[model samples]
Target chain A: MEQSTESDICTDPVIRDQWYPLRALAELPEGATHHTRLLGVPVSCGVTRGRPWARTESAPGDGGTGALPVIDTYGYLWTSLGEPPPGVFEIPEYTEPDRRSMNAGSFIVATSAPRAVENFLDMGHFPYVHTGYLGIEPHTEVNPYDVEIIDGEIWATRCEFFQPMAAATATGGQMSKYTYRVPSPFAVMLYKSSPVDPERRDVIALLLQPMGHEQVVAHNFLCLLDDVNSDAEIKRFQQIIFAQDKPILENQIPRRLPLDPRAETPIRADHTSIVYRRHLRELGVNYGVVPA
Target chain B: MIRLYDWELSVNCYKQRLLMALLEVPYEIVPVDFFPGWEHKSPEFGRINPLGHIPVLDDDGFIVRDANAILVYLATRYDPTRTWYPVADPELLALTAQWLMFSEGTTNTASAARLHDGLGYDFDVEACRAGAHRLFRVLDEHLWFGEREGRHWVCPSPHPTIADLAIFPDVALSEEGGISRVDYPAVRRWMDRVRHLPGFVGMPGISPPLATSPPSVG
Candidate 1:
C-alpha cells in the first residue's frame, strides 16, 4: 500500500527494541500528563520529581507495572516498546559546558519516519526548499561528500554548501561545512560550521517519532556553542526552516520511503541517501519503508 | 507619487501592491523588515503610523493605514471603469464592502497561522487553521453559486473588485499556514481567475498561474 489508511504499527523486535523520543521535556509541565502516540501505540508522559516518566496508554496511572522504560537524556523523554536499550546513544557535545542546549519544538509531518529522516539527510534540497536561508540557486551544485558506515552508524563527512543566510546570527554568505550522522534509524544529526566561530561546529538533531506507519513527529533539538543569538532567535530559525519542508514532505509521491534497489535514481549528491537506505535494509527496518 | 511601507512576505502588504499593480498605479516601496528585524514595530516606524503594522500607503502625504482601505482608495482614484469600487451603485458597493469584511476574517486566521508557523508568532495554530477552513467553506459555497450564475468575482459583478485582491493573498498562501485548499474547488478556480487579472502582481509566496505566461523564468 502506498499510504496506510489506518494505524499500522511496526511490530518488529528490531523497531520495538529501539528507543524513540516521545516528546521533549519542555513539552510537559511539572505535574501534567501529555497524551501522545508512539509507533501507532497510545502513550502518555508526565514529569515526576523533575524526572519525566512515560507509560503506555493501557497502563495504570498510579505507576503499576505497565510503565514503559523511560530515559531522560539528550533533551527529550525517550521510551521503548519492547526490550529496553542498554543506554541512550552518545552525544558528547550535548554535555559541553558552554553549549546552549534547548528543545526546539516538535513538528508534525504527514509522512513516514524514514522519509522525514531522509529529508534531514538530503542537502540537494537546501538550495531550493530552503532558498535564501540554507542556500540559493546558481550555487545549487553539491560538491563531492564522503559517506560511510562507522561503528554501526552512518556518517557523511566533508559536506559543504554556500548559504546566504545560514543561521540567525549569519552576517553574510559563507561556505559552511556539514557533517551528517545517522545514529538510529529514526534520528539524524548535522554538525555545521558555526556562524560566528567557523573553527567550531553547531549541532542540530532531528529525532523522529513515528505516530503511525505514515505519520511522524520530528523533534528538533539544538546544542550549540554560541555566545550570541538568544533562545527565541535560534528557535525561530529552526521553525522557519523546518516549516518550509512540511509541504515538500507531505507532497512526496510515495508518502513512505522506498528502500528497494533501483526504486529511485540517485546521483553523486545522493550518496548519503543511498547508504542510509542500505543501512536501514541491513537492520531489517520495515516499519515505514517499502522494500520490494 | 505613492509610497507603500511594504514587507516582501506580508500577505496584507501584498494586497496593496497587487491592487496598485492591477490599477496601473505607480508606487515605490519603502521596505520594512517585518520578520526577524521587526522594523515595523520600532519607534522609528511608529512615528509613521501609531498602529505599528505594515502595508501603510502615502499618496503625497495623504496616508492610508489598512490594506482594505488602501484598496478602496486606489480603485476609486485610479480605475476609470468604476467596477472595482462601484461607488455609484449602492447595492454593488454594499456587496463589495461585505466581502472586504470577509477578507478581515481570512487575514486574522489564515495569514495569522502563517505568521505563527514561519515567523514564530505565538498563536493557537489549531484554532487558526480551523477558523480559516470555516471561512473558506463559506467563500467556496458563495463562489460556486457565483460561478453558476455567471459571476466570477466575490461580488455579483462582471469584473473583480478590491475584495478579490484583498482575499487573494490569504487564500493563495493558506498552505504555508498548513491550511489545505483541496476541498474548496470554487475558491481555487476563483484564485486562478484573480491570478490572470490584467497587470496582476505576486509577492514572495503567491505566484501567478504556470503554463499560461512567463516572466520570472528560472
Candidate 2:
C-alpha cells in the first residue's frame, strides 16, 4: 500500500460520502427527533411515517435545514454527509432464522472513529484488557491470521483465540475461531465461535458515526444464535467488552491513529491492525489520521 | 402558566427545559441573550433575577431561581405521576436530593469548562476539566454497580428523577469543554437510558436516544 501524507487523508472526499449508521432503527422511539453530529455536521434524525430520515442543520439551534437520504438496513438507520454510496453493506448472517439480532447501544469516544474501528479489530488486548473473559496471561499469543483485500474491503480470516468466557452465557474456557472484516472506514465486523453452538458463529459489527475528526459514536450490532441468554444479556456482554476498551482508546497520544509506518512499532500480533491501517491509508482516509 | 428565563445554549437553562419536557408541562420561554449581548446581566433582566442567571422560573407570578430548585418546584407541582420527584418515598427522595447536590459540582466544573471554551469565559480551563473528571469517575463507578443491581437511575428508581436531568447536560456536553467521557461507560449508557424516556428532548450537545424495538422472543 502507498503511504499518504496527513493532508491527503483529511482532504479525501470519498470517506464523507460513504453511508454511516447513525442509530438502530428499532432503537429510535416513535415521533422522537434526535440531534447528533455526523462528519462534523450537526444533524437531526427521526422516523416519519415508519421510515427513518436524517437532515443537516444550517444553524446550531434550528432543526434540520436540508434533507439527507436515509436507509434502514441490518437493523440500523444509515445516512451520509455527502452523497451516499449505492447501498449499505449487507450481513448474510442477519437473514438466519434462528439468529437473534441485538443492538448493544451507542458509545461516544473522544478518540477518532478510525482509531475506534482499529481497536475493535485488535485481539491482542483481549487477555489484558478483557481479563479472564476474552484472554488471559498464559493465552496471550495471537496466532498468524490471513489478511487480504477483496474488492476493496479488508478481511482477516483464520484468526483464533483462547477465551475463559467467550460469551455472557459462557461458563468455561474454549478456543474461539474468528474472522474480522472492515467493510467501511469506520465500520468493522467480527464473526466468532458461539459458546452455545460452536457450529454457529456469532456476528458482531461496530458501526461508527464520526462526529468530528477526533470524536465518534460507536453503535454495536450483534447477531447471535443463542437460546440460553436473553437479548439484554447479549447487549450487556458487548457493552462490557467495549467499555473495557474505551479507556485505552481515549488515552492514546495524538488521538488520531498514525498511518506512517514509523509512527508506532507494531508487533507480529498487530498484523491485522497493520493491514487495516494500510488499507485506510490507501483509501485516502486522513480526517483522523496523523503522519509520523 | 410557567415562564422560563432562557438561553438556547446555556446548560443550566437546558436543565429546566429537559425536566419540563419529560414531565410534559407547557411553558413559555422568555429568551435572554446570554452570549454576545449578555442580556442576563443587564439591569432590566437583573430585576427578574438579581443573581443575573438566565434560568429563573416564574409560575403564575411565583418565582424560583437556580436550576435544581426549579426542578424540585416543577416536579413537585407539575408531575402528577409523582415519579419524577417521588417525595412520598423517603429513601429515594433523599438519594435524589443528594444527586442534585452532586449536579452542582458538575455544573461548576464540566459546565464551567464549557463556558470558558465556547463562550470565552475567563476561568482555569485545566482545573475545571480535572475537577469534572474526578466527579465523573465517582459517578461512573456508582452507576456501574447500579447496573449490576438493576438500578438504572441515580436515585435507584426504575424511572428517572430530576437528578438525572440535573447532571445530564454538563456530562453530555463535557466534550465541548475538552473533558472526555470515554472512561465512563456506565455514565454513557445511563445517558442513553435517560434519553429514551418519553418526552425526552435534545439541546446543542445532548442527543436523543434511538427507537428501541422490543427484545426478540423465542
Candidate 3:
C-alpha cells in the first residue's frame, strides 16, 4: 500500500474556501441565525442562532434594522431539504492527482483518528496543549526526511525499535509483539503480513471526531480486514466502535487544542513526530519557530 | 399495534399519548427513563435512531421519530374524521405545521430547560431562561394582540386541531419552569380548552408503565 501525506487539506483550495466562511461565521454572533449569501446565494444560517447580528454593527442596508428577517427556524427546514438554486454556490471540482505505480505488497489500512490529523498539522501550540502526549518536542527531532515519491504518493522511513522479552511458564511458550505508532495521533497502525504473502501488509484508519467542543467520537475503520459484507454487520460494527468513542470523548474537558512544536525536547521515540511535523511544514502551516 | 417510546412526564412525549388517547386508538406505551439512561444513548436504541433522541413511535412497522413527526403521522394514518387534523386544506396544514415548528423550535427547548433547571435537574438556568423568555415574548405578542374570539390557539374555527394538540401541553407546562404562563391569557385559556377535552390524559408527573402498556397512536 502507498503512504500519503495526511495534511493534504491545507493545500486543497476547496477545503480552504468552504472552511473559511464557516469558521468566520461561527465566530460571529447570531451568525448562525442570519440570512447570508453563501457563495453568492441566500442560505439560512440556522445553526449559530443569530449570534452574528448580536455581535457586529448592522448598518441600515443590512436586514438587522428594526425589521430583522422573520428569524424563523421553521422556514429553514424547507430550505435544507430543497435543491440548491442554480448557480447559487460555486462547487469546486478537483480531481485526485495521478500517482506513480509500483509492484508492491497488499496494504491493509488500520483504524485512524481525525483528531490526530487536526493535531499533527496544528504546529502553533501543541507542547502546552497535549503536554503529556505528543507535545512540546524540538523541531529537528520530529522532522520527516526519508521522503520518497513513488507513483505520486509520498513515503518516508524511520527506524522503530521495540524491547522484546516475554515467556509463559505454564505453556513454556514465548510471546513477542511489536507496536507501531502512526505519524497521526488518531491511530497506531501495525502492519501484519501473512506467511504466503510476505510483502503484503494491512493498515488501520482510526477516526476520532470531536463530537462537540468537549466531546469526542472515535472509531477504527479496519480497511482490507475482510471482503465486502452485509450492510447490517457493517452498520452494527460501526455503531459499536462509534458508541465506544462517544462517552470517552464526551467526558473530556477542553477536548481540542492548538499544537506548538517548540520549547520542548524530543527523544529517539519521537520518530513518528518528526514525519508528522515535516508533513505540516510542507503544507506551509505553523511549525514552531517558523511562522506562517 | 402502535407503540410509543415516550416518557409520561415529558410534555413533548405527552403530546403523542394525548393524541392517541383522543383518537381512541389502541396502542402500547414503551416508557423511556431519562434518569438511568434507559433509552437515550443505548446502542440497541441508537440503531432505531442514529441521533439518539426520543419520542419514537412504531406504528406496526412504520416508525415516526420526532414528536411533531409522530403527531403528523398519526393524524394522517388513523384520524379519518379529520376533525383533529384536516388533510384537505393546505392553508390549515401549513398553519398547523408553522405552529408545530414554533412549539418544537422555540417553546419546547426553552420551557424544558426551565423545568430541568428549576426542578434541580442539571441544566443551564440562565441560558435556558433567556431562551424561554425570547420565545415567550413572541408567543405573548402574537397572543396578546392577534385576532382571537373565544377559540383555542390557531384551531382555525371554534375547535382544537392537531396544532393545538401539539402546542397546548408545553405552553401549559411552561409555568412548571417558573415561567409566568398567566401572562399570556389567550394561551392560558387555550390550555384549559385542550385539557378539558374528553378522554384527556394529563402527564400525571412520572408514572410507571403498566404490564400492558397503552399505545400512543393518534
Candidate 4:
C-alpha cells in the first residue's frame, strides 16, 4: 500500500472557478448581510429589495457594489471565487410548482470537500450509520448501480434500497429508488423516492463551499413534493441523518480524501464513489483529494 | 443603559453582542483594541476589567466581568420573556450553568488557539486545538441525542438560553484555531438554529442566517 503525502496533493484551480451555494435564499433577507469565505476568499452576501448579491472582497471590485456575479436559484445564493462557467446547474425538479423547498442548513466539515461529497455518494454506510431509518442489518445488499460521466457530470442511476424510515412522515418500510448526480466537484444531488408518493421523487442537493484544503461548509437544499410533514420536521430528519455521518467522515485519517485505489480498499458497494473519484481525478481536483 | 467593552473580532465580545441582539437590548460599545493595539492591557482599560479582557458589561454601574457572566446577567435582566436565562426552572437553569462552564473550556482551548494563530498570542497551539476537538466531540454527541429527544438548545427548553450564545461563537470560529467541526454534524446543525434566531447578529467570521424561511425539503 502506498501512502499519500500532503505534497502529493495541491489545490486544483478548476474547483474555484465553478459556482457553489454560499447561503440559502432564505438566509439572505432584504437589507441583511452575511460574511463567509469561499475557496479561501472573503465573500459578503446581502439582499436588497428581495434581490440577493454576493461580493468577493479580494476581487477587483468596489466595496459592496462590485463586479461580483451572484445568482439566487433553487433556494440558494450561488457564487464563484473565479469566473463561473455560464450559470449554476439546473434542477428541472425545482420548477415543479407543488414541491416544497427547504434549506436543511449549512454544515462545516473538517475533512476536504471531496471527502464530504464522496460520503454523500455512498450508500453502504446507511445500514450501520443510519440504522432502522435509511437502512437496517438484514437489508445490507447493495445492488450494482449504473454510473456514467456525461458532459463533465457524474451520474448514478437505478440505485435502490429498503429504508425503514424513508421520511419524517414515513409509516413503514419501503423500497426507495435513488439517482445521484455530481454536477460540480463540491456539489452533489440525489433524486430519491418521495415518502408520500413512491412514484414521485424528491430532489435533495448538497452544495459545498470549500473553505480550505481540509475545511468545507455544506448547504443542503431539499425539494420535496410531499403533503404530509411540516417543513421543520423534514429539516430535523435530514439534520439527524447528517449528524450520524459527521463523526465517521471527520475521523478518516489524512483529512484529505485519497483518489488512489491503493489508499484504501473498496468493495462493490462503492461503485458510485469509485466513479465519482475517477471524475474528480479527470478534473484534476487535488486540493482536498490525494493524487493517484 | 448598558455599556460593553468590546473588540470587533473577539469571540468573547461576540457572545455579549449576540445575546444583546437576541434580547433586543440597546447597548453602547466601548471599543478596545484587543489585538495589535493591546488596549485591554492598558491601565485605563484595566480599571474597567482588571482581568484585561474585552466584553465587560456594565449596566447602571453594575459590572459583569466574564463573557458567560455577562450572558447570564443580560439574559436575566434584559430578557423580559424570561426564557434566555431560564432561572424560573431549576433543572433547566442548572443545565444552562453547566453548559456555560463548558463554554469557558471552549474559550480556553478554541478561542485560545485562534488567539495564537490570528494575533500571535503565545500559547501551545497544538494543545489548544486538541483540547477544542475533545470538547467539540462531547458537545456534538450531546446535541445529537438532544435532537433525537426533540430538544434544540443545551437545555430541554423549547427556546434557547444564554448557554447557547455563550458557546456558539467559539464553536463557530473554531476553524480559525485549526479545530474542525466536521465530526460534529449535530453541532453544525445547532449553529444554523442559533443563527436563525430573531435579531441574531454576527461578528467577524461568524455568519448570520439567511433572511428568508429556512428550507423545508423532505
Largest lDDT belongs to which candidate?
Answer: 1
* lDDT per residue as tens, model 1, A1-292: 0122334756678888888898777656699887767776777888987878888765222233468899988878999988967887798998889999877667666689999989999989998778788999889989999998998899999999999998878989999999999988888999999998878889999998887887787888889876777665566677668867877887787988899978999888999999999988998888888875
What candidate 1 gets wrong by more than 4 Å, as runs, is: A1-7, A59-65, B1-93, B100-138, B141-170, B173-186, B192-218
Candidate No. with top TM-score: 1
Worst 10 residues of 3 chain A by lDDT: A100-109
Give the share of true interchain contacts found in each model. Answer: 0.02, 0.00, 0.00, 0.00
Model 1: clashing residue pairs? none
Ranking by lDDT: 1, 2, 4, 3
Backbone clash count for every predicted candidate, in the order shown: 0, 10, 43, 10
Backbone clashes in model 2, listed as residue pairs: A9-A286, A26-B211, A26-B213, A27-B210, A27-B211, A27-B212, A28-B210, A28-B211, A29-B211, A127-A135
In candidate 4, list every pair of residues with a backbone clash.
A26-B210, A26-B212, A27-B210, A27-B211, A28-B210, A28-B211, A29-B211, A102-B215, A102-B216, A103-B215
Task: Order the numbered candidates by DockQ, best leading.
Answer: 1, 4, 2, 3
**How good is chain A of candidate 4, measured by TM-score?**
0.91
- What TM-score does chain A of each model score against the native chain A? 0.94, 0.93, 0.32, 0.91
Judged by DockQ, which candidate is best? 1
* Model 3 C-alpha lDDT versus the unseen true structure: 0.43
lDDT of 1 at A45: 88
Which scores higher on lDDT, 1 or 4?
1
Q: After superposition, how far is residue A287 of candidate 4 from its true place, in Å?
A: 2.0
When summed lDDT is taken over every stretch of 10 residues in candidate 4 chain B, the lowest stretch is B209-218
What's model 3's TM-score? Answer: 0.39
Give the interface RMSD of each candidate.
8.4, 15.6, 20.2, 14.7
The better candidate by DockQ, 1 or 4, is 1
| Alpha-carbon deviation at A3 in model 1, angstroms | 15
lDDT of each residue in B1-218, candidate 3, tens digit only: 99887654556777888888888988986655432223467787888777777789997888879878888888888888876677788887777788788877545556566445322345565566567677766776665454444434564655467877776666665544545555666565445556666777655321223325442211
Candidate 2 structure quality by residue, lDDT tens digits, A86-107 = 7987799999899888676576
